[model samples]
Target: MIQMLVTGPKPESVAGRRSIAVLVVILTGQFMTVLDGSIVNVAIAAIRSDLDTGGAALQLIVAGYVIAYAVLLIGGARLGDRFTQRRTFIAGLAAFTLASLACGLAWNEFSLIVFRFGQGVGAAALAPQVMTLIQRTFTGAARARALSIYAAIVSGGLLAGQILGGLIVDADLGGTGWRGVFLVNVPIGIALLMLAPRVLPVTVARTDRTVDGLGLATLTSTVLLLVVPLVLGRELGFPLWSWLCLGAGALGLAVFVLVERAVTRRGRDPLFAPRVLRAPGLLATAVTLLMVMGTFGGWLFVSALHMQSDLGYSALRAGVQFLPMGVTFAAAGLCWQRIPAVAHARMIPFGLVLSAASLGWLAWLSSAGAGIGAAASTAFALFGLGNGLAFSPLMTRALAAVPVTLAADASGLLTTSVQLGTVVGIASIGSVFFELMGTTASSAADAVAVAQLICAGTALVAAASAALAVRRMH
Candidate 1:
């Protein structure tokens, strides 16, 4: 059934009729992108088995999307600033839809991997514009509500993918099975394509904006430095080259900072605003987000694998495992409007403590076993509750200080932190888990214990950082 909301032009406020339409459209895209991230995690083994490919080919499909998505994030925002936000949004939607079709119809494993990367490129153009619209179109209290709604789409995207992947893989959908994962987006994209122009306002850029290609290239190279090692680390026996990639990634990142500072010195808009970085609270929050989301990203990937491979649960069952978290996320997002009015400066630290406690509980569960048993259920729910509160707080606080002129720049910083966190998380902790889990005669028990510990510790460190940043702001 199609869900439709009637909205119009010249609505009294940004969050009035028109903003609703844009939000709906952006949500659909956001859902598709993030869902793709996890939906494939559970199905990787199945995909490899059916396609008769090695783990590397399968991993590229996963890593390819993250890499492409991360690479394109800032550039995507830049495109929105350079061109028409509405045009960029439409073009990105069409490209992503076409790529999804390609992935669904892939005749070979290599084709599937390639198409997924293309889909990610499309997402890069689409995702940033969501924030751009919210920041541009809405204001004051309404803006916070708008931002909260959009944040849910990000989390909803993840849970939806897990559910769909599990259901499709289990259902086999007339033997289409894993292919349904990609096919699901086609209809949503088509709907958005038809409706977008009518509902989304044509917000034009103020002036001629030149893209900082050097910065973009340097940033992309720096990220791949960390991510490549993560997906390939275990398979390659954690060689010296992987270590070099890690070191080089750090160096490239440092170089990227220098390049940005230089660009800002030229009296031009850098890839990210140098001014925004000067806010001590914002910088610390960015660092905390990098660790928080990175650890969570790695945790989701490993959890899906553990559910299917180690526990011998069906894909559908694994999806069910995450249902509680999904439910809480939705509730928390919807209620986020109340946080700023009620919680004030304390919200960030509060959310962090909530998240850290959940991670600690997750550590306990992994130590016991994240199976369908009672012990796992209690701990998982606690973790989900923490996540529900944590996600929006970080996003809200990070961008709170960014002025209207710097909205896009602030958005880019936050998004980049997410990608950087994901790359490092996969490389750092994912490396640790994959390395230990696949080796030794008795690896499963050790891997779970170690991975959970890493997750717990990561969350705690992030919590401490958030607390410190919030306190400083006070």
Candidate 2:
């Protein structure tokens, strides 16, 4: 028999002294996850050198973590709902810390990749609980504000990771060098692990439900089959295996849908609650994120390439060039709390339009040449504002109506969509840009303009979809 999860929360308000404690714990967990994501990007070369890893192996170092992380997210969230989120969280932290130590002390690329996968496992277990806990703790107004702050900080955390990545590798920190990057997390993880059990609530799961193993297998296969080939395909010139992986990925997804349906027919809560997928509000929210995050990821990848490869900016300089946009994102996140609650969902559609406009303008400006500094300024500010307003609202709105009983599964669904979108975005756009640039007899300025145009087009589609979805919500 499928047991219904016991929806236990301390209090909805989380006001005064008690709620404050929980808030810190929840936000801390979120920051850690966001931080780890981008932190490794800037340090990839350092790791490769220290471990004597090759390009393929180093890519594995990153890809392994990401693939494992993405595959396990739904499973982790379901586990949290089946057990206590608090206990699951504490355990995840402990494992993550230990894994970080293993990563730092590793002697080879193989060990590093394995430990990184372990790290991904820990992150998967820990992440959804952040959303689940926030839902349990706050009411309407407080919840919206907290989500905005969370979104903004998560954005900043990614940017800060690049900065820290540079500083740590350069500082060499007693010649432990790249090792410091992983080692630094150990102490923080220990501290959070210790504090979390004390501050976090142990919401009970009434169900002793086991995970839908068939569903898990099918989903994992779908992601790997799709992402691995796409990431490697262009570089390998789209070999036969690439075509096979694509076909297999599609097949796996088909099977997954069938499996979910079968489990639901048996009167059990499937790997994901089918009911959650049927909610217009929830599904809209997920689709919005799917498009929004894809645009964001595309922008990040293309902009970095244009700035560094075409414009001749130093690596650090290229990163700094993005500072204006990053700062604007941070400011909006901090101030988003002051905005009226009734206006929260409205901001998403508006921001989507603004983002589309910014992308459109930036493409024109880049086409005019890098000397159009003023145009660049305008584009960055607009893009930042749009993203800041849209992302948080999209997340908050999609999550608002999800009952405590279904929180974990729903959160997992969103997380999966977000990551999958990013991977797909990079592959789809990056492939187009690289092919177009290589074959064209155009100047560097023209090539960048082409890439920007692609990004603008994607952003435009995202904006339109978001608007349509929000309209349906009303």
Candidate 3:
């Protein structure tokens, strides 16, 4: 009875025609959200030039969305539990659609930043509900398959952002340039809204009615302190204030843990359930994921810069260079769960090692003065294959130990961590790249080589952590 309850609904009842439509609608919304995250990256130069903003402003445009999404993610998950996943998801999609429209029409940097933040908030509100619905709707093998496809959407969306953004800007549709990226989401969101009500499964809301406001406050504050400083610190030259903010963030994290423990002890629901923290090897998994994603984000930013700024490739041409990675990611994602647990454990380390090796090879190529060519494309494909092989296994390994009741918490935390890692990666490695460049055009190749090496280091660390985590699991 408990197992049935945890699984939510029987496979046949929810995994039918209606459910397929529901999944399509939900994944479409997801593709839009994830697309927004990366699409803006390719458009950053256009956005900056058009808006007459500085580099710092462009960074804010990117980091602002990420910060909002990360901070609100847990709250969004809790809301879905209180309000029902279907309702929460629909509401989120509506807001996201509206936010995307606002982003499209913004006239100034300030307006764009505000709208971008709104889009992030909307994304947060919708993201957790996807995983929650999958939990409630699919069972066993079907659930694994659904999750693999969802992972593909995530990776594909990142690639799409670069590819689609390049195409839209290069095409200059309606003379909108970068605006096309945000505007594209409006129609997609509208389509999802129309389809969702007709197909989504309605599940009962959980009965844990109380929200631990203090826990939420502390957690948000902690994350803000950590993330805000990382985003701005390099631009500000790592002032004393940045160090103070980092210190405060650490203190705030400690306080958040204590506050949540107190809330749980008092028999009130905590912002984060204590049990999720206690899950075996989850901490290691989170750390590994953070490092892996951090490398991924840094690689994206660095490689794009290398292609366009260093190699003088057009945006569209550079974007096309990433197609191989995207293709391999989708293909490998489908086969993610087929590997046995023992093999999966080794796959993480093996994949990361291969990923790092590819990056290192690319770095050597750049240092040797090789431009983007057949050799670089092959290296990129190998990197993509490694990424595809690693991501799903790591995600599955982390969530596998979580109780079904705590799925929402795990989902929110995991997504938040990924976004946070992205911010950190962009800030830290990007700073390294810029510092290496030293305001000289001649240094571009050297800077890119060094940045790729740094990314390889991150991948190696992730591999070490994943290997250690698996060892601990045994």
Candidate 4:
């Protein structure tokens, strides 16, 4: 079956110079999308001060992009299926680039929020295609290597965003302040736009171009209902409307399942094929991804707060603190394929255990009154190494479980799990951190310790799920 999938002429074979260019272009797209997700964090204070933004609006500025991106992702992948990956990718990139410009030039809080949402829309359109392109273009060992690089970019982009955002905001380049963060993408986007058309492979479109209108609507609404509340619930004190949205979102999920099944029965391509969920090992992989990403997200959020708000580190200093972890993560991701294939399944569980242990170490350091010093940094690096070992392999496994024909579906589903996990983690663990951060630095340190333990627990759960996924794969 695997041979049959790769027997055809490779769409754009992952070989030599051309393959390098293709990866560069596509991965750059992925990097930009991921970068924008976290880049605004360090800039938020600058944005609020510059725009005189209110608290609710400030929250929206931060979260609006994620909500839109998560809601539209699966549909975006379906678009790639209908339109061809190359075309959809270019179009999405165009939208994202222009939105970045708009965000940079925004006149007020409202404009920035709206433009940020536009950025999300463009990201939604582009991101899944990155993985889909990799899936379609590469096979066998070559595929694994490409995925490792892809995973590295995902992890690295996140850390880079923090570091770059701080540097940009601190420099206040051309007095742009926080605006520089958005503007930095403009040139990169333009260069990619020019190169993408020439470099990207021409993928064949799906035969069934028929739109799954109901599926799209229901799925989008469900995601929006779930994501918006999670993104804003803590800020708004989890009001009645948030709970109502959660309830409605649950109902919408059930309806969405029914709608997709109906579309499948009618012999039409649904926005998301429900059968993809039933594929061996896919569900377990999704659960593992959700927990893993959630833990990472929660750590990023609380760690930043603890470092800056409590420890009196500047934004630039706080951002720099992540370097050890990011470096190790990139190194581990690039090197993991060196391990023998037979032991690959064990890597996920072992890596997750490492991550959990590292998190526990971090908790111990925090509780023991250790600041962001050498010991804590070592813990961070270890956690990153562990995550690096697991993430790429896990992604490869998830895609491998499904037919190549459903690449877009698998990509979309996996990415959505990751994004949703980030939101869920920040909301839940962030709330705990805030609750515990009472009067003094000691209290805040204690809060961070508890949060680290919670994250450690989450990582262990993810490890169990990953083990289950590996078992199911065989």
Candidate 5:
């Protein structure tokens, strides 16, 4: 099953072939990392009830992982460059597996949050290597196919988290309930860890670059300050301390940018490569990707809560409702490359617009109290198709302009933007939904309707970004 590609000068076992086995190993790491991002939401209620914790603690269980992952992504990517992609990938996967086990055994909220953060750190280490490996291992149409499949899996993982979490919680295997969600990653990770060294292609480590310690510290502070208040502020009634934290986060970001620019000017490697910033369509793609993917996180959060809390659906029923979206996403991703060049260029924008419209329709249906029936299912399917068409092409086009040398850096930046987008969407939009539900005494369905409206608006802007990117491409 393995086909030898441009095998490098490494040992025979680690070089000389690109196989499905290698692809699976890389993509599985990606799937696990992305899966952990959203799986906990489905089990949030169960986790709270079982652990006897409050809403704030539950939010931390989710947000802590994201924050850690987002802040460390660039550093993780740098590690891949400095310490060989294969080594970092294996190390990260091992750490992630151990952390997942710890999370399952956590006896209290504090322990769970700490372990979740560790899981994020592990994910950050592995994420950039997935894309880097793809860039190194494949070329031409094969590369395009690989990237498309990767995109599908990433999007699919977001939806699957709910499905998997729901199943585990409903099964209550060994009376563990929500803990099974984390535990399930253990065997899978262990299998990947064992197989990786035998199948993965090895590349030379770039030792010229070192970690940007100052840049890392400043960026971490910036992300924490911005994310922490949004997630915790409303729960604490928007205390003055939270407002101060937001202000400080803004200041930290300013400092981070200046530091990065200086680092670039001094002929030293910065956390973010200066050259990547100059690439056409890169900035636009990053913004659009963030906006588009952010909605995925926010949508799942509000929808899961509304379905379980308001519609009184069982966990299984709630998760099943998203099946339509997952199916269409895979279908559209597979077919996107078959379209004509002219039409293909329009795919991202058109998909975004279609997704926005579908989401808006779903919002209307929710407000009308149409439950998880045929109409809502159809809407989700349409939304998924559009999202599929947009994301696969968007990622391919975005990275098409990146230099091969900076592939790891670009991957890190892309993944960081994604995690940040997901966290922000969950914190801000979820906060809006929760606050509205409390103060207005609106039904959960009604709050979800309002939240979906915000998501729809973000989709519209993403469409605009896609349009701009297309123009730049031409």
Candidate 6:
């Protein structure tokens, strides 16, 4: 059946349909993984109340998944390259589904934390394959359209997680409470698992199948050392050990670079190909993505705090307030392709500038005590539109700059930057927000306004980076 589909006459239509199916299945997986990251946020209080979890344990339950996911992402991408994306994706999905079940059934805080980490490991394995499949399966306009949709899903999932989580916890579906958040993945995963093998195309595995054990170990260690501290430092009050780990992480990064170079010189495949980094415009794109995502992460965190803590909004109400932003973001992502291709390169910086402007508007509104009214909602919508315009095009250009052979490496690098940026933004900007709130003179709205200004500044820097990327590429 697979052979016939490949060699069959006038197979373009069939192939197109298959591509759509593949996108649906894999993107469903992507949504599940991405949603899980933020879905637990609204449920934290419920979980803590039910399981008697402490602050530290609760933090772990949240951060552990992210740490494992970020650390193993590149390795997971390599696995797809080595074992074929279809096979690895299935394995990852299966692992994720089972882990979700375990999380739902966890009896204690420790058990739930462990299961959450397992979910992250599975997600690490699962997430990269979505991009890899998109790269390999589609071409030209189709690829652009697919990427736009992918960006929407990635962005929307974050907001949707919070909204859906609030609804689920408030409704207490079947009296499952917080457990419903994790268990929600079960049916979706099973459906995707059944459909994937039929719809997903089989591709030839890479001939250089050898694993780079040293490169993998060093890279994982470096990321673990770096991400662990960033995720935990605020909760732990930035202990001396956290600082030491960060220093060691910096050194470990140097070691990893040296090891990868040595492996490349030996004609052996490194865990991450260094040549991918040398790809024109890639580094600038990475920097742009880092800053853009940082702004987004910070905005989400601080805005939620302002709404809930200062404005006395419920979780669901706060999540619903973000609906305008999500809608505008998805609309912009999908419609960007309609714009002239000649102007697409310029859109990144334009979008960033627009985002910065909107963020500044938000800061002004917050400071003036405008509250969550039409004006504030409009600003949120504008911010979303700007981000939507920037993100998809940035991703398309970055992937286009690299050779198809290094799709895995490019995917790993881009995705890792996004994840790291989110973690760093939350930690750093969140610290500033907390510190300002603690001051006697500052109100919650004041802290949020300051955070928005910082986010606006980050967006402006990202705009500059995007302009630089355009120059390098052209």
- Which one wins on lDDT? 5
User: How many backbone clashes can be found in candidate 4?
Assistant: 0
Whole-model lDDT values for every prediction: 0.75, 0.72, 0.81, 0.85, 0.86, 0.82
- Ranked candidates (lDDT, high to low): 5, 4, 6, 3, 1, 2
**What would the per-residue lDDT of candidate 4 be over residues 398-450, giving only the tens digit for each residue?**
78777677888899889888877776676667767866787887898899999
Q: Which is the winner by TM-score between candidate 4 and candidate 6? A: 4
TM-scores of all candidate predictions against the true structure: 0.91, 0.87, 0.94, 0.93, 0.95, 0.91
Please list all clashing residue pairs in model 4, or write none if there are none: none
The lowest-lDDT stretch of 10 consecutive residues in candidate 5 is: 1-10
> Order of candidates by TM-score, top first?
5, 3, 4, 1, 6, 2
Off by over 4 Å in 5: 1-17, 439-442
lDDT of 3: 0.81
- lDDT (tens digit, per residue) of candidate 5 on 215-245: 9999998889998999899889999999999
- Backbone clashes for every candidate come to 0, 0, 0, 0, 0, 0
Mark the 10 consecutive residues where model 3 has the least summed lDDT: 4-13
- Clash pairs, model 6 backbone: none
The deviation in Å at residue 239 for candidate 5 is 1.1
TM-score, model 4 to reference: 0.93
Which stretches of candidate 1 lie above 4 Å from their native place? 1-12, 337-344, 438-442
Q: Encode model 2's per-residue lDDT on 183-216: one tens digit a residue.
A: 8788889889889978887666646566788888
Q: Using alpha carbons, what is the TM-score of model 6?
A: 0.91
lDDT of 6 at 346: 87
lDDT tens string, model 6, 1-474? 444322221112225567779889989999998889777766766787899986457657766777677778888888888888889899999999999999999999999989999998899899988888888777777877888899989877987987998788878889899899999999999999999999888877664655788998897888778767765676678899999999999999899989989999999978767778888888898889989888987688667657765676766777788888888888888888889989998888999999999999999988886679999999999999999989988889888877666777788888877776775676567667866775333476788889999999999999999999888888
